[model samples]
Target: MGQGADHLTSNQAQVLDHLRAANAPMTAYQLLGRMQNDRGAVAPPTVYRALKALEEAGLIRRIETLRAWAPVATVRPGVVVICDDCGTVRGVEAPGLLESLHERLVAEGFAEARKTIEVHGRCGDCAEDRA
Candidate 1:
């Protein structure tokens, strides 16, 4: 519910609402299918536009591994986690770790650097299933 919502069309708002309501990440195609089934018909571009806006606003994130999107409740910068098996993602808080790494890099005189720490592994359900 950021200022990004103000820029969204009603269609975009509807798409964002649906994505937030979903329990799992969903591809644009999947969202399009649901919209078509419920609203009778929908265009692909509309979904893409809405997703792009939501992503830019940091209200949602795209899971590269799953090729899907999910809402982001927290925005603690410099943190990202991804489940390798199911592709479920969660944001984390690791300022200490990040600070340590940053200090080390600064000592080495690395001026510009961005951090994206992605941990890949099976989620709880996948681990249980495998077990």
Candidate 2:
């Protein structure tokens, strides 16, 4: 699906590259700082625009609660799990059952329905640390 990235603008490509290489979600300001450090003096609006374009292209997902973005690693629906203590973000590919549910929703006259399911909890490592 990200095959369309071949046409991405330079800034958009930069943003996507950073997200793809990141181990966790990143906020726009973080991306801007990285870009600025590497390329010298990047504008906040530039980073934001690139992020918007990448999101619209379905190449990234926003962790709404964290106000952060993560690269899409698969074509399947994603269930984002976030750690409250360490701020770790992980994406789980949901079962095909969700596709059927979405289809049912569309059939029930909810044509514009969109959902992003997020689960928040402490990760195993964090839990172990606490114990």
Per-residue lDDT tens digits of candidate 1, residues 56-111?
87777776657787777632355666667765567778889888998888999997
Query: lDDT of all predictions, in order shown?
Result: 0.74, 0.82
> Candidate 2's residue-wise lDDT over 40-131, tens digit each?
88899999999888888878878888889888773235588888888768877777857887888889888745687888999899999989
Q: Candidate 2, 118: how far from true, in Å?
A: 0.9
TM-scores of the candidates in the order shown = 0.71, 0.79
Model 1 residue 59 lDDT score: 75
Residue 111 of model 1, lDDT score: 74
Clashing residue pairs, candidate 1? none
Best by TM-score: 2
User: How far out, in Å, is residue 23 in model 1?
Assistant: 2.1
RMSD of each: 3.3, 2.7
The top-ranked prediction according to lDDT is 2
- Clash numbers, per candidate: 0, 0
lDDT of 1 at 113: 52
